[model samples]
Target: MPKTYYGKYGIEVRTNEHNHKGQKAHVHVYIHGVEVGAFFLDGQLMVGNVKRKDRIAIEQLILSNRDEFQAMWDEFQKSAY
Candidate 1:
């Protein structure tokens, strides 16, 4: 997993190739240690567990760095095998 960005409020965003079964290439957001949510690299929330107060910032973070995250995912997959 590569951390793509970090923000205030202890928010961190990361992308990983080895998510649970059935998950797509996605970004995971964490606050403290708990996973706040999982989102597609395109910035769409695949499953919303994100804290309400942090949703906007997280979304913006994803949207702003979608391409970089996607690239990281692609590279990770290529190197994985």
Candidate 2:
């Protein structure tokens, strides 16, 4: 997994090249090292729960770093073959 950390929050893009087939590009969120959930690049929560305020913050972070995240995802996908 490729991870980026922001203060107490962490974002990770898990490699799906050998498994998780059909899973969309997304990031797993963590707070204080605890997994919170997974979210799409658009900031939508794919699964799990988060406080409203935290969700908004997460959205902002994701949106601001969208390009970087997408690039990471693309690289990971390219290795699928």
Winning candidate number (lDDT): 2
1-81 per-residue lDDT for model 2 (tens digits) = 778999989999877654375667788899999999989999999999999999999999998998998888878776744
Model 1 residue 44 lDDT? Answer: 70
For candidate 2, the per-residue lDDT at 26 reads 85
**What does candidate 1's lDDT look like per residue over 1-81, in tens digits?**
445446442323333335443446777777765676777766677775766668777778777877777776666655533
Backbone clash total, candidate 2: 0
Alpha-carbon lDDT, every model:
0.62, 0.86
RMSD of candidates 1 onward, in order: 3.3, 1.7
The superposed Cα distance between candidate 1 and the true structure at residue 32, in angstroms, equals 2.3
